[model samples]
Target chain A: MLEVFGRRPYLVLLVMALLLAPVPFLQLNDYIVHVLTLFLIFAVFATGWNITLGLLGLKTLGHHAFFAIGAYASALVSHYFGVSPWITMWLGALIAAVAGIIIGFPILRIRSMPHVAIVTLAFAEIVRLVFANLKDITRGELGFWGIPPFNPIGIGDTAIRFGLGNAAGSFALAAVLFVGVHLILLLLLRGRCGLTFLAIRDAEAAAESLGVRLAAWKLFAFGISAAVVGLSGAVYAHYLMILTPTSVAGPEMLISLLAMIIVGGVGRFFGPIYGALLLTATSELLRDFGDYRMLLYGALIIVFVFIAPAGIAGLKPRLGRKPAEATKPVEAV
Target chain B: MSSTQFIELVLNGLITGSIYALVGSGIALVYGTTRVLNFAHGELMMLAGYGVLLFSVTLGWPVLLAALATILLVMLLGAIIQRVTIAPLMKREDWAFNVVAVTIGLSIFLQSAAQLIWGEQFQGVPYFFSGVAVIGDVRMPWQRIAILLVALAVMGLCALVLFRTRLGRIIRATAQDAEAALAVGIPSGLVHTAVFSISAALAGTGAILLSPLVTVSPWMGASYLLKGFAVVILGGLGSFGGAVAAGFLLGLIESFSVSFVSSEWSNVVAFVFLIAVIWVRPEGLFAGRGA
Candidate 1:
């Protein structure tokens, strides 16, 4: 199984996708489909997060700012102007990208690593506070409701609707988005820009000496990542038909995203997807444990950091190498 | 606002600012010596608040005794956490990321555990000192004045320890260069543990002081954690005196914003100021030795 997966990776991905495609039609309960749909959405969200965190080596606790921006933008446009969500989603992404650039430019220019994390966190808090206080627009803590769903795509008599109002439709939309993002990320990873990002992450000084524009590339990564996350947020708002500060820009969202990437495998192509699926599933299964879910997630992080800092995807390389070689310390960038 | 109102706001800001400095200095001290940002710093404070509640409110101990005992307990927990989670990952190349992840994990663990044990209800202990003091046109609560006085006293003690003593010298050496400190027979590991414990103790003290001002909840640490970082950053990372100065500055900023603008904008203004400060002077306002 490992050999086949290693030799023809696409085959494994295809099989996985094919298996998941029929999940909605399997006559499973609505709760199951709902969870799966959430899994898919977060899979996309986490994947987007990986672009900045794993590949670009940016420590951001503020991606939720972009998520909230996309959510509010989509919701507001649809509600105030009666625009279709399909169009407003892109607008949301664009606005988020701009906001990302605005924020990323200053902090990325001055701060590095851990400082970036705190600054971004502060930025996210600022965004949340602004949204919460802007009662006229965001309705304060009461939140905005009755958001219109994305218009369905279909021929005259055979319309195919999609959104949270219909569980299957939500699943379908999320699945398609997950695949699209996955493909885009895969393609990018195979390109020069992706390699440059990895080089920057591994050794910024060396990459800079090699003529790579560190600031530009970092900002680019930030913008693209924010855009993708914003798109997910836009969809999330429309699907849930409600937008709130807690739902969009809360620490819980940030923690869950961090958990997904850490557990799945940082910098690995399938890490976020795997992490999202496994962690989300674990959380769902542990629903019986009530509030212990967060505790479990926290414990999982601590355990992973100590026992397997490389995460599940990183296990393969450890297994493949000799013990002595594997144990040799690598210099931290 | 009138002159009395202005004086009142400034006084209140100083009280809050002193608390921020007290907490921020602890964080700055730990980072100075260990190079590890304890994201769980606020969680330690929250734990200390709960500790106070348990001792004084539930067990009916004296407030002073409960406060002292809780600080000591949290200090021990901080040292243990450093030993168990942070110490192992210290030698790794990816120390920054690993330390951060571990602390965040520790934070979540503590928060949930607190919730499980203490339940979700917000709890508050009775004020250790009550009544108002009037000075000229200004009226101030004695508890608020106590917060400022205690915070200043602790900070002064911290400064004295860091500047005047042998242990202070060793901690300073470790903060400057760990390898050099170790070569000179200073156990850097022990110093790290000491710093962690001291930091937690400071946060615990702040938590106890703050318990009467705000309801104690598992999630109370979240906001304080951010504000603490803002203070540390504005003061300068690993700079003791810088954190103190920045703490008061941030307090005034927040207090004035709350008074002049909407109360909601106070936090937003602090963060915005933090961002601006970082962008303009990332080294911080005071830029202490070795910063």
Candidate 2:
């Protein structure tokens, strides 16, 4: 039954997923590729969120702040200073990481679930409003268009024009980001570092008592997550060659992240890809319905949360398979 | 700012805070009974606001009728939400936590549905007054005074019903401990529905009151919902009077910030207050009391 990978069923599923997904991306239409591109981008984002939200079990309803931080930082640098988009993306991540520290310092101070989520929500909204109104820097809600083209993945300055290969290159970049984040997460979550994060998730005071520095680690998780999200935002901006507050702000960013996380199952390394695919794909297909599609999509997630609290990936375990009962810190409440 | 402007700003802050209090009370009530944050509670209020707005503007009904109808309808909806979503969650104790995601999802559903139904147009709902009131040199709007006065009245009534009436005692008993209330023959199931219904009704009241002052849009409830969270955290969760006070405190800070700082900084005041409360007092100012 164990074919060749010699791993568990889910692990095999992960291997197969990576092996099979490229088939569709390489063959799909432009629209499908666009959505797949979005899905892969969310894969990186949700994975970033998953490290803290899924693995560490933190609930952040305001992740858009970090995403925006990355977008704005990169966009500003590329637009004003004529810096290469590639260099600016990393800058965005670093700036976003700093913003994450600012948010985490105060957010981690909160004890309860609702309090933390609400505070984070307010924090993100305030930042978004500021971005929308800051006409000089962000260009306000009017947005900044004509971003520099993404330098294709290659050695030297033989820079390939972005979107030139009719969706292949974009999807390739997304796939690379996805794989990079996925591998990073897999490595981190399997080691002593992961266990420490687990301990902190389980019992903060106990983790502190056990000599694990709570603030430093939590800040680390926040910063890393923010950095990844920033990278996704930067990629999104440069790829689309357009950026707007509405595009990056509010629940759209979080919903996609949350949906991917929820659909994929929390705490599983490969869970985010499933979440990204299902939520992103379904919403994309429904967008043609004009308005109510998002409403219906939102309603579907509510139904899913109530019905499949463990999410699609966690479903098998719920049916007597004994899923990892690793201490899930942030209960939905 | 001038002395008159300063006094008016404070007064305006108090008024805005009062509206925040009523909505905050609704959120706190649901949170108190269920211990789950109902993100849809804002959407419920939003729908209720639109209900009144539509009745008054489109159907040409009296404001009172529209307001009452909206409250009752939303209350019914709340009872159904309790029966369907909240009740079933009691089975799997962990499912209660899922309310966070579910309610957020529900809020999104409501917002988008309202947008699809009413479009994104910011529609006006006329106030129940004729014009602005002139307080000597400083001119004050009657809608602002009415909003504050009604908020105070509603808070008073909520206090009276939650503490004074026999049903109020039962509600209080349930809020304290559901099992103990059940042992005393209080129907906990009915209490859940009742509490949810009351919460929705309060939201409806707040929405109806707010609809006239602020233009009704699909996303109007988003800020109110966030502010309500701030008020509950600042005032002390489940402490009705504390919610009342903190709601005004938020408004006062906001108005003053808008006057002194830029309007851009106004939201910063709310966000800072939220972070401050959660940082300073995780349990809020008066969290555990029946009040």
Candidate 3:
């Protein structure tokens, strides 16, 4: 597998990936870049959710709570204590990880897929409810604004010379994140835990018989996945400089995450990336279609799932058996 | 704020919860039989709401007629959905997937369709009973009282049918064990379609009965659907009795919370309880009732 994308090919793809990162730099205004930045934010969330739903064979409809937790954690730290958002982002991730781990232990022990999704969705909704109702603490629906922006090391010096503003700096920060996440994901895919995750997806009974700790790995994957999503949320809270309970744990965000994973192929390495890009971009591109946008997207997803569970990109393998093609990478847990 | 208001709150909560029970039972029945969570089930209720709004508000028909039209039309709509859309997808393990995906798609489709047909403005369905009634010193809306009574009656009929008749036996058999029901010569697939129809009909009843209290809007189903899903989870997914109890419980909680807490906090309270319950006991408050 590594030979096909040998050092030279991988280097080229990596350069291409780096080129993709500079999209906001070429953009004219902050609005476009901000939306593009949102795409990046959701990409991280979708990838995190993919770790559980796709890799672990656990269909979760909740994780919105984790996202909210991270945002709240960072927001609380920055808004109240005047801590740096970058530092608080890690704290937010930790909080969400702990919550995810706690939830995973009991819920993942149950033996049903749809039940898990239902229960998770309920949990997320409850988190949203609490956040909305806890006006004294979280500020409820009015939302929390005026969060201090992040400043990376050595970036201020570079920004002064380049004359880049907050928006541009935000884009740069997100770019680094995109690259970091991709690298980490690539490493995770090659690990033994990744293989165990895939085995669990294939057949839990068989995997259990093979000595994989059911609760342990499931909780591990859910925890790490949540931390990743939480980090994304923390960055988002600081970047947007506002945090609303609705945006954090709402229908639209949940649907976006689900749509990305579903359309991209649930268990593929690039599913979240490809899916987020397609859905986010297309949802914008076809804005003129108004409400039909979701309908069309849903239809497309249904057709894809029906004909190609591995997703449209996975269709490359069916034309001819060539070792050159990237095998449909099962997004291992 | 007062002792009178407290009693009023409890009564109001019970009334609102009655509507939830009707919707929840319908959803549970279909799920019990078909193992499909119909996302569009809420849409049917919305459509019924619009139906009554059209009949009572726009057409200026009698309230009874509007209510009847809603139930009939929505039942037909449910049957047609099953016959045309759902029945074709019933043969595979992917039956539930197609059901969920298509219903989600259809929900978006129906919401927009309503938007195009009725416009975005909120349309009120006139109260079945216009004035408030008093039992002792506590005043109540006659419509609220009527809604409670009708809701209970419909639920009672539903329970009777499920537990007392030959058709009920078939539904119970299918829900209990589809493979065994089929082996025993019961047509489980047909029963699934029928149960789905029955479920939609119940949602339609909720729409008609509750329409007077709540305004009809294109996106009304979204919020209500979340509540229905929550009640299902809280009560145990396929348990009819559980759904009824949970519906009341959620409603009562919302009512009392809204009285003591902020009105905005009521939904939050209900949802938080939902999450806590699921977090503590993933099976929900009941056992083996979920997918």
Candidate 4:
């Protein structure tokens, strides 16, 4: 069974797609739909983050800075200039990408992992502080509210509307973004640049010896990852219709993204997807635990690090026949 | 600002820097010996603060005794954390990333557990010394002076140990090269445990001193953790004396920034300074041996 599934993984993806295709139309309650929408948005974010963190092997604890920048850029642009989110979102992404390159350039020069983590974390704090202090722009702690939602497009008199005021439209938008980001990442990882990334990650000195421009590729990964995360943040801002420093760029967001990728299996193509679904579902289920929710997350990280460092994606082979053989192809994929 | 006010801020910055130096040194110690950042260092400091609250506030123990007990307890906890979580992962190919994740997990665990145990209320202890010292129109709180004195004394003691004692030599050896230390029969595992304990004890001391200055809460450690990281990086990772010097430098910068600029911008200035340092001089201003 494992062999068959492993050999025909695209079949599994197709089946999963078919299963999820009707979620918005299922007439699920608003709460469930909203939660699903959030899950999808975060899925896009975690997947994008995985490109730099998991694949490129950069340990950043401040990817939320990009996300926050994107949200703020899109919201402010729309609020002041009355630009459509359809246009402003890309602008936000471009801003975030530029910020990423600027931040990643110098820090990536240092080879130390902990140094990278500290610099990135400090960069995020600086961004958050700037946002909070710029009350005229971001409204400080008052928060930027009433962010205009994604407007509907029209064909002559008749209109095709997202109607994101409701959960269904929001869910549809999130799903499209998730699928789009996921495919881009998947294709990127399957190509030659992906091999370059793998080479840099596994052996930087060796990759550099082979004439691979280490600085350029690392910056590219960081920029692309930030752009993708920025896109998700734009969607998130529109859906929520409000943006706060803590809500958008807080340490909790970074932790959640890290937990998703770690729990799913870092470096696996579908790791963030499995991680997002399982973690989001579990957190939702354990909502009654209230204060204990974070405690559970903490425990999950510890347990996964110790018992299943490879995460859920790493568990399939252990449960299958010819476990070692089964693991090889999955890892290669 | 007047010279008196400037002097006061500079003194205050030094006091703050002393605490930061103490905390950063602990983090540096652990990192030096184990090659682990100990993301939970601030959490350990938080735990120690709670320990003081538990003993001195709840049980009404003498402040000094409570502090001594808390420091000792925290040291043991740090050693155990290293032995249990970090030591086991040392052999893994992904030790660096795994250690980071485990420490992050441990940090969250310690924070939430503190909230659970302490009921999320802000806790505090009375000033260790209640008085003020006035020198040439510059008035300073006695507590602040005591903090600086105690931190310097402890750091002096740590320096003496590291330079003058056999265990310190072993630790230094291990930090320099674990395999070489092991080949020389230094028992690198014991050195790791000792380093972690010493680091935690330093954090506890800083926490006990700081508890009187700030409202103690479960989440208080998070900011300190960041500041400690900033100090560590500015000092250059694994450089103890550099961390101490950088701590003072960062403290002065923050103090002046907060006084001249808005309070919120102080953090931004500090972080921006950190990024600037990283970009310009990754080796740190006072690059110590093996930094």
* TM, every model: 0.95, 0.91, 0.89, 0.96
lDDT of 4 by residue, A206-240 (tens): 99999999999999999999999899888888889
Candidates sorted by DockQ, best first: 1, 4, 2, 3
The 0-to-1 C-alpha lDDT of every candidate, in the order given, reads: 0.85, 0.76, 0.76, 0.84
Report backbone clashes per prediction.
0, 4, 1, 0
Per-residue accuracy of model 4 over B91-110 as CA lDDT, tens digit each: 88878989898889888887
Residue range B1-291, candidate 3, lDDT tens digits = 777887888898899898888888787777767777877888999988888887788888887787788788888899887776677767655455555655666676677777777788987766778888987779887888988898889888888888889999888888888999999999877888788778887898888887767789987767778788777777777888788888888888888887578787677678767767876776668654331
* lDDT, candidate 1, B174-275, per-residue tens: 999999999999999999999999899899989999998887999877778988888888888889889889999999998999866889888988998888
CAPRI-wise, candidate 4 is: medium
- Could you tell me the lDDT of residue A247 within candidate 2? 72
- For all candidates, state DockQ relative to the true structure: 0.71, 0.60, 0.37, 0.65
lDDT of 4 at B230: 88
TM-score of chain A, model 3? 0.87
Local lDDT at B156 for model 1: 91
In candidate 1, what are the lDDT values of residues A28-83, reduced to their tens digit?
89888989988988888888888888887887879989999998999899999999
Q: What is the per-residue lDDT of model 3 for residues A1-333, given as tens digits with 9 covering 90 to 100?
A: 222122343354387467766675685577666667777778888888878877776877788889999988888887899887768989999999998997786576576655676667767877787888788888888998777777555744554111124666676677677778767866775568778888888789999998998888889998988999888888888777788888889866776677787777666656677788888888877778776665666566556555565553354455655455446442212
What residue pairs are clashing in model 3? A267-A331
**Between candidates 1 and 3, the lDDT winner:** 1
Considering DockQ, which of the candidate structures 2 and 3 is the better prediction for this target?
A: 2
In model 1, how large is the Cα lDDT of residue B287?
64
